[model samples]
Target: MAKRRLIKALAALLAVLAVIGIARAGGLYLNHTASYPRGLWQKSGDYDPTHAGEHPYVLACAPGKSVRREFIERGYLPWGFDCDGVEALLKRIWAVAGDRWTVTDAGIEVNGQLVPNTQPLTEDSAGRSMPVQTGGIVPVGHVLLLSDYHPRSFDGRYFGTTPIKDLISEVTPLWTESP
Candidate 1:
């Protein structure tokens, strides 16, 4: 009888742990990157409602193995933020489907206007050559994630376009402070 009770207890414990993991994964998102305003955001399970030129933010992970490998090798991801396998990158959408985007030595341009402070740095803070800016067309089912708030942000300027299917959630500002 005691052994049966112990087995039941273990099963109950496992079920509780599973629920906890799910809740934590679905809980509030904290904007730890300078790419967006610093604060706590509510993560909603919804498709991106952002339009072109709006620059709305979302929670995303590396869309492919190559991007994940680069992020790991180059230290592009912030320390200790691995979500499952790929680290989460919270960023504003510079361009949506059908919007044209470009990255050059001059700066990043979307729809023919250069965004200020987007000029590619020749070197990084660690004195290494900056990763090449891979400009991309905002393809259907993809978004270009970038940031105007941070000049040296590791973003679309570095990673190029991201698949929209990789978005973890749409973040809405719950509490924030000016950058």
Candidate 2:
């Protein structure tokens, strides 16, 4: 009877361990390779990252969007490919630039030269042209994020610059081959 009880207890412990391992692996997989929209880019005007129920300011790629393929190939999932992705990339750039960059009313300036407004010069839905202002200095640990598709994207110009801390993580591909 004692032997049987010991065996059962050991089996239960093993089972728990297996479950935990699977959960952690699954979470890592989702973070790096999942292509589905996790509510990063919400069209709702009231979106707020600080609020529990509100969506974050980060941008994520649309489902089945071809742009995601490039990111996946580069070992990055479209984590915050929308607004957040831009922020992360900008942060990386800032990290590389170190003390040579500055944000201003005209836009980002590198060594006093305005960082060309890469975002397309266009108008919003209300017939008002989107503001070209990149705003403020690129302080240490801060980045000026923008969209890959500037003409059609609502990025830093729409939601403002994001701090490095706000960036969750760099997107990573789940598998080497197509799923």
Q: Which model scores highest in TM-score?
A: 1
Give residue 67's lDDT in candidate 2 (0 to 100). 38
**Candidate 1's TM-score:** 0.75
Give the per-residue lDDT digits (tens) of candidate 2, residues 25-136.
Answer: 5533222222222222212232133331121233233223343354344333434434434222321121121334444655545556553443444465556655444445
Q: Which stretches of candidate 2 lie over 4 Å from their true place?
A: 1-117, 120-122, 134-136, 173-179
Estimate TM-scores for all models.
Answer: 0.75, 0.35
Off by over 4 Å in 1: 1-26, 79-83, 134-136
Backbone clash count for every predicted candidate, in the order shown: 0, 12
**Model 1 lDDT per residue over 1-179, tens place:** 99999999999999977875674576776676676788788876655454445666678886686777767777777543445565588777778888788887778999888876677777877788876666767888888877777788777777678888877777778899976
In order, what lDDT does every prediction score? 0.74, 0.40
Worst 10 residues of 2 by lDDT: 88-97
Please tell me which predicted candidate would have the highest lDDT against the true structure: 1
